[model samples]
Target chain A: MSAIAIGLTGVTKSYGDKVVVDRLSFTVASGECFGLLGPNGVGKSTIARMVLGMASADAGNITVLGEPVPGRARLARMRIGVVPQFDNLDLEFTVRENLLVFGRYFGMSAHQIEAVTPSLLEFARLENKTNARVAELSGGMKRRLTIARALINDPQLLVMDEPTTGLDPHARHLIWERLRSLLARGKTILLTTHFMEEAERLCDRLCVLEQGRKIAEGRPHTLIDEQIGCQVIEIYGGNPHELGALIRPYAQRIDVSGETLFCYAPDPERVRGQLRGHTGLRFLQRPPNLEDVFLRLTGREMKD
Target chain B: MWGRYAAALPANAWNWIAVWRRNYLAWRKVALASVLGNAAEPMSSLFGLGLGLGAMLGRVDGTSYIAFLAAGMVATSAMISATFETIHAAFARMHHQRTWEAVLCTQLTLGDILLGEVAWAASKAFLAGAAITIVAAILGYAAWPSILYALPAIALTGLTFASLAMVVAALSPSYDYFVFYQTLVLTPMLFLSGAVFPVTQLPDAFQQVGRFLPLAHSIDLIRPAMLGRPAGSVGLHIGVICMYAVLPFFLSAALFRRRLMR
Candidate 1:
């Protein structure tokens, strides 16, 4: 087994009376892609901060890259790269200058930064925009540049917080492609995202977080099969309460949400057969995925 | 609590220098425009008030009135330049640009970033103070080599003001909040500190309050040097300015630790 890149034991954090992270414990092995899935204000960002030693944990210990956090965190940070949620690229500098300045933050010499600039730009697919100002770049281009800047230190582990949020589908696809390349290169990655599809596509193993606690932890497909089932039959436009009752006997589990009845079953044909004769019932049948598992574990409530 | 943060700063100078270098590089892009902009207001005030008002007031302290006002302008320029840099420019980096957040993700600590920012603002203050001194020297209103003595005094004055304004930057939530600091604190301090005229000319009550102002001590040190006179209470003046510089730095650092780290 590979060594652990990140490890936490009974970590807890609270602000005033509100406990942000409560007894959270997990580990990501070296060269593996690990995802932290949670809704807003569930303390995903707070966990990222604690692991980086940017914030202190009220209880328990955190180790990253074999160094104790909030103690030797500075030394650990030297071998780690981070892509924060928001774009904080130096708006004053050009594309090359942004990378150059970021490298200096890690104490890398200008000569060393310049030597890697050409390849780094190519990695982000920003070769043509080398001299362009960051403000002039598109949203996707800025996000890519942020990723490239994080790699300036040649770090062993990459910690990214929602690295692809707010991007269009095409842009998101490109980011995922770049991330896959990094994983192939044997770099450990810790990613946080609200997008379950992103977690499913990229993360080798992942954990679901709710109210500062780990609710589920496993491979995406395994969690889907174990926690949910083989298929989900969505029925809309009919009375959700009556339809939920009618399909309950055939489904492994049934959930009614705002004029829609979600029926989870091992076989889609069984649930579909029960809904066929129902008048004015709109239905969609697809294989059970991570979102079903995620929503089932964390619920579909809107969160801040 | 303050000692913990003070000890957190790296013993090596290179990290803070890197932070300084980042700001220098960004400032270099607009060096000409920025330098000219800082020089304009003080230069105009020096010419407008010094030449115009000096004609009516004449000499009060055994030198020409314009010569006296020139020294005060140097101190005032340093104060305004450093204050603006910290409150406006540094506030933008902390709040709007989120530059400090990016830097914190690296190996550098919050103490390192704060030192770098304070150093950079002090550098800007030095330039602004030096520009006015040079102009005053060129115009023959300031002593030849004696004004050289005022250069270090101007730098200390810069450090003092920059350190003080950083506290305001830490407390402020927006650009609009800075106005309260400027109007209520900086403006009154300017008038009371004898930048425009002699402190003795004011009422006894105002003079007592002026004794506590950092700018007053700065002017006391700088005015004598610029006039080519033997300055009195040299150790006391330096001590006061140093106190202002050191104490506020710790205060601001503590405030920023609460603001950013949480």
Candidate 2:
């Protein structure tokens, strides 16, 4: 088997005058969890669709599970599982029937589907809601069922687009656990998400996209350490340049977003000592993480 | 154009059956209600318009008025049943329920989903069309074994109407938009297609318009079959109905490819 699970080379797509994915390229190694992190409409979902062969890219090439996309995409898709952004479970079917119908789409036999249904249900932690209609399932249960349905064919590559979006904290944790289990079992996952915590937790490596272009790509922690340093000091509601000048001797980088000014440095104490006399400034110091790298790379502008 | 059509074809011919089965499983829950709903409208027209109106008018076209109307009812019922299934029910699956989007995520292509939907709609229309034919046969309004020939014509009519309605389904922005198709297209087509009256009775220009209507082609085949007479120009009638079935399918596929896949 090829080490590369998904490979995109200079892939570009345009809708009329607007470019959605522009000369973007990446590859996911087999059994690795790779995340595509970007704000809304940055072509994350479009890349996911192109990888699945649901949409054709205008330029360059894509291969999934060693099969060229939009050409042998059907064959490639037979081994690919997808957890779409929204819960699109069939409201007409019970929990079991949803899996049954989805399995049939992959040409799985009745016996094969019957054998797998119970285990998938168990994997999704929905053993008790076996025959319940999709509408009857709670939001979390519906999301779990959607994941379980995706696994019926035991696909080689699992593509999840914003899998945890709109999920409550508890539900989000449960999904993260299931995903971790899949990774433990050597499943290659290609995920697209806006949740920095999700990417930091689940992804082995990730890329940051802005305006349909790759800004940075590496391990989550490595990118954070390299891009924003070890510490982030947030000084809220003050003149950014005036406060930034206070820490200029200690801080490596200074950035302003909205009402807060961020001071990044390797040593927190040196930066904090500079603000010791600034009691009324309402500043706090913390370790830098993925969000700092994200906001720094992609900016804090709101994207609809 | 030919290349695009080839690309639009299902990857595997039989893969569409899964989509058909999905719909069948869903419809099974409301099977009785769905079947009754399809049959009730046509049966009422048979009773109210065919019998009541037939009594006053007596005989036309050298046969009883109700008998001539029975054939029209079969064709009209099939058309209406298929149209509603595609425009309203299939639209719900496509736009509101997002079932088609989910299906696309699988190995199935848009062509497979559409083929399944069109087949299912045609099947539903068959049931409604068959119910009228059987009732007419039982009531001595239609010829015995010869009326059986109308069954295939009815099914074909379903395919024609279902395929045509898919164009409307693909283009409609919401359920509200269906009213335009129903009012401006379908209801007008019902009267213009010579389903209830002979096209010969209309002005020559109006009669020319009827020749292009899909239902008119369907009636040309079905009415003769129901009346136990050999149909005239069977090749032309079948050719026109087949054209209606095929042409709009590609149109819908093109429209949906832009709207959904893009």
Candidate 3:
């Protein structure tokens, strides 16, 4: 087999009595995109931190860039870039200055850093924002600029934690397009996000975790196929609390939420009869998707 | 492997240089205030206490008050540099900028980053001391040979305090802790550490007690050097100053490492 860019064995982490990442093992091959799928509070960020050497694991081993990950991991961290969940951009510095300063952290000369900055700005579509202070940029602009900053070192492995979060649909798709383009060029990427659609669109393979434990693992389509089947019948109106009594006889599982009920079954069409006599109800059927699979694995209840 | 580590020093230094640039711009008001405030305290003390008290008191070990106060002022500048650098500037880097965290993400280790910070802060402290000394000389209060030794003496004090302040910053959970140190620790030490009055003026217990404080030893080294007088007992002073310099750095490095590990 060819070399793996990242390798891990039973990596574990905990805070006080609360375990954040529990005995997890996985690896990302060189020149491939790997998605880390998990619900909020499932230790996805914890794993990412361990990989970055930001946090040391309480147990187990890992290797990154052919070295023991987070231990003897000698690959210059300057050769890796991280897009944190929250923007840590220097507000005082202009977009270009931010990149320049970050480059200096790796000992890059001013001449070397400046020469590469323009192309990174253009790649993130923020070329016009070269002189603008980071604080003046909008959220989408900031995110894009962060992506550009991540590429300044020409990183071998890029780690993104919730990159598209808190963005409009147009911005999200633009990010997706940029990410796909990166993958096409054969860069190794590790991604973590709350949005399932992003994972389905970008990940080659993913593992889902909940409360610090791995719950499911596979490609998005395969996980959806195994957990949520091919069809879903969504019913809205009526007292959703009574949905179990109304739809349980016909559906495989009845998920009562707010004024809507999710009837997850092998055939959505066959479940329409259970709701036929129901009063004050509207219903629709759609194909199975990554969102359904995620909700099923992590529960559809409101998460604060 | 060590080549990469060595290469990262300049990288780490660059981060501090960038921070220094931004800090100078963002806190220009504070910098101007530091320049003025740092200079003013010494000058005013020289005029008020040194001149006023010296006219009445006659002499300290037989030197006039204006002359005596100028020597004290040189020591004061060292204290001010250490105070401003360790408390105000260091606090902002830890709390506002999160500058160290960003720098550590590179190939640079924590040790290089600390050294860079200490270097920059020490440079600033030395500048303030040198500026005050120039003013003292213009007023004809300085002795030339003592002035020659003033730089090394004050520079050491600057490192001592910068390292000490870094420990304070690394260990403190908030900016309030810095204020607490300035008031409770730094202020008393400044007055009691032989800056204004000679430790000889104090009672017997206070005189011997003075030897233990890092600032006292720093004062012992800086004052006599600025006055062209012999610095008493070189070995003890250097030993005490070096202790002041190294202890806090070890503590701060350990603390920073603990925080980063989390």
**How well is each residue in B67-166 modelled by candidate 3, as lDDT tens digits?**
7767667766776676677677666665666666565565556666677677667767787788777777777777775687778777887888888888
Which 10-residue window in model 1 chain A sums to the lowest lDDT? A295-304
The lDDT per prediction is: 0.88, 0.88, 0.75
CA deviation > 4 Å runs, candidate 3: A74-76, A299-304, B1-34
Model 2: CAPRI class: medium
Query: Higher-lDDT candidate among 2 and 3?
Result: 2
lDDT string, candidate 2, A1-304, tens digits: 8999999999999999999999999999999999999999999999998898778889999989998887777788888899999888998799989999999998889899999999999999999999998899888898899999988889888999999898899999999999999999999999999889999999999999998899999999899888876678888866877877777778777777877888877787887777777756876878888889998787652211
Runs in model 1 lying further than 4 Å from the true structure:
A299-304, B1-11
Two-way lDDT contest, 1 vs 2, winner = 1
TM-score for the B chain of model 1: 0.96
> Individual DockQ of the candidates?
0.58, 0.57, 0.40
Q: After superposing candidate 2, which stretches have Cα over 4 Å from the reference? A: A237-241, A280-283, A299-304, B1-7
RMSD of 2: 2.5
Candidate 1 lDDT over A1-304, as tens digits, reads: 3399999999999999999999999999999999999888899999999888888888998999998887778878898889999999998799999999999889999999999999999999999999999999999999999999999998889999999999999999999999999999999999999999999999999989999999999899899889886678888888877777777777777776677778887777877887778888787888888888877886762211
Model 3 TM-score?
0.90
The TM-score of predicted model 2 comes to: 0.96
